[model samples]
Target: MRSVQRVDKCLAAACLVISRHAKFCEGARAMRLLLVTPIYPPTRGGIQTLLYQLTASLPGTDVKVITAKERGWEAHDASSGQLIKRVWVPEVSPLIRNAMFNFAALGALYGWRPDVVLCGHIVASPASWMIAKRFKAAHVVYAYGREIGIRPALAAWALRRSNAAIAISAYTRGELLAAAHGATLPPIHVVSPGVNLPDDIGRCDASRPTVLTVARMRDWYKGHDRLLDALPLVIQEVPNVHWVVIGEGKIRAELERRAKAAALLGNVSFLGEVDEDVKESWLSCAHVFAMPSRYPEDEAGGEGFGIVYLEAGARGLPSVASNIGAPTEVVVDGKTGILVDADSPPAIAAALIRLLTDADYARKLGSAARRRVETGFTWELVGQQLHSVLDEVAIAQSGP
Candidate 1:
């Protein structure tokens, strides 16, 4: 009886604390959040999707988003249902665009004096630093893979002055620390991005196995060429296997030409930029999802975190992520899906064959993958993690 009373008391105290936090989120006194990013919806990708969900989840806070002008953002903004100021930068050269964006951010700093300024990428570190120093506000920056480097001394200096930094993966955090060496940097919090979990996408069509790879053919790192090389081997084992490639990029024609020259054109379908619903439908139809991604040979470009694996999992599809970089964080090697040497054709082929050939194993991995997303990598969970981080920063700044 005494223990039960103690538990009740503790619950009441917790509730009181939560209520106080709730008030901080709900009024004119709410935390003023300023988010600056180079990309956002309707330009969908891991980073944009994460920012969208995280922003949506943090309702009741005074949030302001400053981003570059893109085609679909107007539509997305209409659907967002939020009444925040949306600053748009005109399309131009990289340097000019960054200058314009920073100028806009500078204007916002003087006008609003945000309580916290959160930059979606380190590219805007200088603007974030200026906001933090000019006004007594917390400045935070996010580091994604391949985006951090040594050349931008100014950005690095800005990052060093930030109140905190968020890394999408442990690998990325390590990369950031190495890149920002010799600078007085703040603690980096590893916060993996999340996906919106879906209901079971139904069982795969066992009669005709399908392997889907969805990614824009923007760079060589996507490993589309490697996957194509493995196609013949995969076809040898699973005769009727069909490879579905969904995404559009400047190199699409080149990839298609290669597929045709190799006489594998009939087995492959390159569907350009697809609707969200259509993409989900394809995920539902796929038995296995594969993206043999790799790090660029030229420079510091690697997958910070792959959200596509989680998306595949949500649709009850097993993933075959590359055994490289932070993919290990998303796909649990044998449990979620097989991890193969992304650069090796034979390895990619073997992994794909194993998943498609053994229906029982594929289903088990798919189911496990879905459960993993539910337990950890959902958008709500990501938002909560970010919310907690922001709350911590706010609390520290409001120290008694």
Candidate 2:
């Protein structure tokens, strides 16, 4: 905790001294990389976080980012490292924003002439494809489960044109290949998501047992519906248990209505889109973390990897996850955290009951979760793997 605080203070202070420029860090690698994506910081989301971490620490590489012009986001991103070129094409219609961004990225690609053009988001792959081919750069696409599943045709076109891919998890890789419907797919590097680990873990308050779930509420597969249903039953078992629902989405009003109708107003909290400090506070204070995410009946729109589970684990919090998708890979059945049937209210309630009722056992699991993260899921390790994979692709495709 002390180390993290010191690091935060130092980083914050350095931000004031540093100007957001295109200068390469000393000893920056020889790679000339162009990252094209729709979303970037300070837009906020899992994708943005992953992209930021991946791009922020690269050494010796001439890096440039071309992202969509999201108001209030591009300004803060300069501090994130590399030269940011926001595709600020005006749209006559609001719905055509992506098209505008695509055209802007396409225009910038011809002159930049990067050795490797990576698609930060799957949606950015098409423009990257055109530019990579024209510039003779290795075209690499990132396959996140829903981004491909939602737009199968676009994903297919991008995948076919790309040379390689970076899949967030095995589940995501499988989902992408399945979404392809037998189209020839490129090599997928199964690089699981990582989280920032805390140096010190806050002690859990036995009296006010809190269950934390951080996710976009608009996502139906996130299983907020099932969690809400389980809450009443969970309250029956652990009367003092409180549920903290973090992050905002389209269904916030509906979820609030349901909670109120169920008379769980006081027990439930909706801390929508909290800052890092508040998020850290909640993660530290919370006793147990639960996000009963599941895939739809069509087996679509699921977690590629439960990064929030990793985040909770990193914070020394035990997770209660659904036994669907990549959670089985990230969260152990009993060692780190417990996994229950997806969308099963009874199972969720039972799991929560067990975690909230047994403090010693819950702490044991939390400790193990922390150990798991320390050994396997840190940003350092993830960055190393990602960098190596990208380097391999660039080297292999670099012409004789």
Candidate 3:
């Protein structure tokens, strides 16, 4: 009876404390968040998808987006049901476009004010930094490993001004630290990107071994070339092996030429930039997902977080990824997927053959991958993590 009375007293005291600072608590709960990003969908990229999903998941918060105007954005913005401001940026000159975007983003912050200003990409950070200062809001930057090293000076300057930095993976967090270059840095938090799980798990076709690679062939490090190099070896062991490549880039012609030189025209198909339904269908039907991405000579060019791997995992498809960079954190070697030397064609080929031949082993890994996504990698989890970070910073800045 005495213990129960003591608990009641403690609860009463907690309630009194909460009631005393109710307004502060309310502000924290209904945080006004503004995202300044270089691009948003219908632009179609991992970062764009991430910002959209993360914003959608945060129903309690008031969110607005400032991004460059792209084709089909009006329809996407209307369907999103979120307040979005599109800035006109010319496509001719990189310097002029970037400068215009920064100034336009600044001008867009007219009527409303946000409690937290998020720089969705480093290119937006300078404008975000100025906006945060002008509004007396907390500044946060999303750190993807590759971008930090691309423009080291700008990355450092933006990071130094930010109150906090959110890294998409542990590897990215390390890169953020390295990019600091001895300057005092903001607190870095790792928030790996999430995927929407399919309602039904995909089953692989036993008759034909099919490998799927979905990525823009923008850079050689994306490992589309490495996958091509490995395809011949895979065909030698499992003839009639089919490889489907999705996405479009200038490098597509070069990759096609390489395939023709090897006389792999029949085994390879390039489905350029398909619809969401089509991509999901491929994810469902394919036996394995492979993008053996590697670290290039320039440290700035590499995978920050492989969202497609999670998409495949969500569909109960095992992945073939490089044993380096961000994939090391996303994929569980020997359990969720196979990780191999990204630079070695033989290593990639061997991993593919092993999964293709042993259906039972592949299924085991795929099941584990699906379970991992269910337990940890969901948009709801990302929202919760983001909310916690926002609350912590808001409360700290609001100091009693």
Candidate 4:
């Protein structure tokens, strides 16, 4: 059984490599893809970023993105030469907003008549499936961690309806299979997120520990509070340890208040919504990247592959991520980085301490992590995998 599993993995990796090379090979035709995402560029989040990268990588493909235009965003324009369309919808009142946006998306998709519709996130899946059904177009759904957890009825319906489904991590794929309860749904493709590595690598010093986390200031899911709680313990072990958080969200002020209350304000700094250069700099300078994600009741948001882990790894920086959701796949325990129990302050702090004290060990993990991503997770690779999936769906749909 173990040998079979190993063979399967090896085959999958080889297929990925072959497919990637084929995409760059001569005489490759790009498929017209319609991406249905809840949010797109100008909207700040991992999913949005992933869609942006995927669209950018697929050359010669007529890519059209359908997304909601939240406040502070201008009306959509195809200025980038990509077919972009935005439907203005109310951000407030979830019920009405979803209904209106989905209806608008369906209308746009029917009129545009894309060869395939790729929906990002389960919430958008139902609408994408509906559009596909109405137009008899092929449909694929992208499931992140939270969408597959415990399997909500709507998510299940969406998955069952789509021609194929893509999960960001193995952890998420397992959860989705379990949710299906032995019932065959769609073909599940595990495509871990990718990150652009920096050209120059930085050195990690054991004496002056630098801990960094790049995530929105969302509540328990991002685990800002838990990181704050662990700070005191980390500071006790390494007095000069500094924790830097990048990105901003709704809970920014509240998290700041909590950090101040815990007397962690001095040790922690919040650098809100940093640009790519600054983010890469932070990842390079940091000795360890930590994120202790906790499952929230809503389950709409949770750690999904934690692309920041890959970003950190690319910079030759080891990480300490929580043992929850898709983070387990991104941070290889005792290999790429340390994985600790979720929401446990002491466990998180201890992991940080270990990484800070053991410079050689940390460097080894960082090197391995960087190699892992470079070998498997690259935008070119991801784009190739996606194109292959699209081709399969298109062929299957055109069957006699």
User: Best candidate per lDDT, number?
Assistant: 3
lDDT of 4 by residue, 77-97 (tens): 434556777787876787677
Clashing residue pairs in candidate 1 are none
Question: Per-residue lDDT tens digits of candidate 2, residues 1-400?
Answer: 9999999999976664342211222444367888999888878888888887777655446788888777785458655656888767674674477677777888865456687899987667778888898888899998777777777777778888888988998888887787789987889889877887777777645358899999987778888889999999999878878999998999889999999999998889998988888888888899999998888877456787878998999888999998878788888989988999977899999999999999899989999999999988888888778777877777667633
Candidate 2 vs candidate 4: the lDDT winner is 2
Report model 2's TM-score to 2 decimal places: 0.89
Report the number of backbone clashes for model 1.
0
- The 10-residue segment of model 1 with minimum total lDDT is 149-158
The alpha-carbon lDDT assigned to residue 171 of candidate 4 equals: 75
Worst 10 residues of 3 by lDDT: 20-29
**Tens digit per residue, CA lDDT, model 1, 44-67:** 777888877787776446777877
Look at candidate 4 and tell me the lDDT of residue 147.
58
Candidate 1 global lDDT: 0.80
* Top TM-score model: 3
Model 1 reaches what TM-score against the true structure? 0.89
lDDT of 3 at 330: 89
Q: What TM-score, to 2 decimals, does candidate 4 have?
A: 0.84
What is candidate 1's CA lDDT for residue 340? 86
Off by over 4 Å in 2: 1-29, 89-95, 109-111, 204-207, 298-300
Q: Which is superior by TM-score, 1 or 3?
A: 3
Per-candidate TM-scores read: 0.89, 0.89, 0.93, 0.84
Error of 4 at 312 (Å): 0.6
Off by over 4 Å in 1: 1-28, 109-113, 149-155, 204-207
